[model samples]
Target: MKKQFAIIGMGRFGSSICRELFHMGHEVIAIDTDEKKLSLARSFTTETFVGNGTDESFLEKIGIRNFDHVIVAIGDDIQASILTTLHVKDQNVPNVWVKAQNDYHHKVLDKIGADRIFHPEKEMGSRIAAYLTSDTVLDYIDLSADYSIIEMLATKKVAGKTLIELDPRKRYGCTVIAVKQKHQVDVTPDPAEPIKEGDILILIGDKRDLRRFREGELS
Candidate 1:
């Protein structure tokens, strides 16, 4: 299904999102106060508007409330981002996703009812740190404060076991959702499929359990 997304601000973060969403077949409206930025976004977005996103009248005129999702990606100007987010919320947009400049900015957005808060730089840094720190962990995605999904290289001990034999959910509190081999991926991997040394297991569970699993308890 296609979704209508309004991206406020045309800086790197916002522009990247706009282009990706456009490519993914979503209807994107890119708005920016800078003429140059708006011009750059015009080719990638379904619609491009040059205006101050913090202006309530301008936002209303552009029908921001109609969008399925609204993203406030203003950079540097935390004030503008907050005001714009507040205005968008007042208009009763279904989902509001905001980018925070820092912890303080995030707190304010949280208070104002932002449906989702994103700290892209901090998140990217964490991802890079995870990759650098562990050879076994291929990737990490936070599902919630208590839960996470991780991709890990299968160790020698786990190589020949089936899902039923390993009993990940009962033993480690994690479920093996899929397996990624060199050239193929098996979604919802079968219980009878034997794990291989080079295969990557996609597992989902509580963060603490994932940490324990990474420590070779399941080896």
Candidate 2:
């Protein structure tokens, strides 16, 4: 289903969201104080506005309440970012997501009822650090402080073994949610399905359990 999205900044992050959503056949309205930045978004979205996003009147004029999702991706000026998120939330946009600059920014966005808050830099940094530091972990997703999802390459130790034989859930308290080999992906793969040497196993579990499981794989 197509969704309508309003992005309140034309910076790298906001522009990326606008471009992707528009390319995916969603209605994307891009706004920025910089006319030049807004102009860059024109090819991706038909609706481009130059205005102060912090102003409730400007938001109202743009029909922000009509949007299914609104993203406040202001990179700098934490005050403007907070105020714009406040105005968007006040307008009662159903899904309001914000790019938080810091922990302080994240807390403020949460206080103002942002549906989701993301630290894109921190997230990417963590994922990259994981990949760089671990041979088995190809990707990592932080679900919470304790829980995570990890994509691990099936090494020689586990190659050609079935999931039931591995019994990750019983032995390590992790669940293999999916397996991908080349272009093909299997979700909730059968216990009898054999894992290939290069297959990527997607597992979800507590972070501690994941570390232990990975350590065992290394040993």
Report the error of model 2 at residue 12, Å.
0.7
lDDT of each: 0.82, 0.82
Give the range of the ten consecutive residues with the poorest summed lDDT in model 1. 124-133
For model 2 the TM-score comes to 0.60
Cα lDDT of model 1 by residue, 141-208, tens digit: 97776787889998887889888887878888888888999989999788988888988989999866
Taking the tens digit of each residue's C-alpha lDDT, what string does model 2 give over 59-125?
A: 9998889987888889889999999998888898888888899999999889989887878776553
Each candidate's TM vs. the true structure? 0.61, 0.60
Predicted model with the maximum TM-score: 1
